[model samples]
Target: MKVMGFAGWSGSGKTTLVEQVISVLTARGYAVSLVKHAHHSFDIDHAGKDSWRHRQAGCREVMVSSGQRWSLTRELRGAPEATLDELLDKLGPCDVVLVEGFKRAEIPKIEVHRAVVTEPLLFPEDGRIVAVATDTEVSTTLPTLDINDPEAVADFVVGYLAL
Candidate 1:
């Protein structure tokens, strides 16, 4: 699969741009998958749900299936956080994998930036950053696209990956 990442500081619109790109990409007949990394703890199951109950009862992994879809939640517990490659191994094949966060990983990435974020550009320090999607005008050798132009960004990503 072609792997691309979206990296930026908090409130920089990475998630929004990724969501838009996914919609455009999917509409264009490409199968896309997303993998997001969260710094803080998060929950995908509610307290009263069977999956939640199974997890609370000390099940290492719980797979909940229905006719349309299924989700597998695994508890890492004290185990070290899994690497990007390890996480990707668990995902089924797709034409592209749009990863959010995992900024330190050595993969091609599009940095979503906003002037209001007031943060230094990740591309300056990270050679893996291939392009940027921003709200403000930027002058750089790499392509700079409008953050709202999801179709343009999606086109760039697809072209870059030759997908």
Candidate 2:
């Protein structure tokens, strides 16, 4: 599957841009999937739900399935965190995969930048970054795009991946 990534500092609007891109890409008939990296603890299961109870009861992995959809939740149980490649392998087949975070991974990425964040650019230090989406002007050799224009950015990604 073709994979692309969005990387930026916290509060840089990476998630917003990615959401917009997904909408546009899906409307254009491409099957797309997303993988996001969370820095803190997160839970998709609620405390009283059956799946949650199963997990709390010491199940290493819990899979909840229905006719329309299914979800799988697994506890690492002291194992090392799974790598990007390992996570990607779990995703269903799609025309493209849009990843958020994983800035260190060896994949083509668009650096989302906001001036208020005042963070350093990732493209300068990371060769995997193929483009930049910024709210303000950025000086770089790579292609620079307006962060608000999700369509253009999505186009760039689709073209880059040749989807």
Candidate 3:
């Protein structure tokens, strides 16, 4: 599957843009998947839930299944964090995968930016950035996409990857 990433600082609207782009792509009948990197510890199961209880009881991995859907939660248990490639391998076949972080990963990416964030742009130091999606004007040789226009961003992604 083709892969693209969106990288930016906190409050740069990366999440919002990614969500909107997903909607556009899916509406066009593309099977899209996303892998987001969280900087902090996170939990998908809540206490008192069966899955949470299984995890609390020291299960190495707990999978909850139902008619609608299912999810598997694995406990690293001090194991090293999984790399981006490893995580990508676990996903099923899809037309595209939009990664939400892993800024340093050597994959094509769109650097989402917002002028109000006051942070320096990442494209200068990252060669994998093929474009920039921003709310305000910016200086760069790469293609600049209107952050508010998800359709345009979706078009860029499809055209860039020739999906």
TM-score per candidate:
0.97, 0.97, 0.98
TM-score for predicted model 1 compared with the true structure? 0.97
Clashing residue pairs in candidate 1, if any?
Answer: none
**Model 1 root-mean-square deviation:** 0.8
Error of 2 at 43 (Å): 0.1
Pairs with steric clashes in candidate 3: none
Candidate achieving the largest lDDT: 3
RMSD of each: 0.8, 0.8, 0.7
lDDT (0 to 1) per candidate:
0.94, 0.94, 0.96
lDDT of 2 by residue, 1-163 (tens): 9999999999999999999999999999999999999998788989999999999999999999999999999988799899999999999999999999998999999999999997788888999999999989899989999999999999999899999
Worst 10 residues of 1 by lDDT: 137-146
How far residue 88's Cα lies from its native spot in candidate 1, in Å, is 0.9
Model 3: per-residue Cα lDDT over 69-155, one tens digit each: 989899999999999999999999999999999999889999999989988999999999999999988889999999999999999
lDDT of 3 at 93: 98
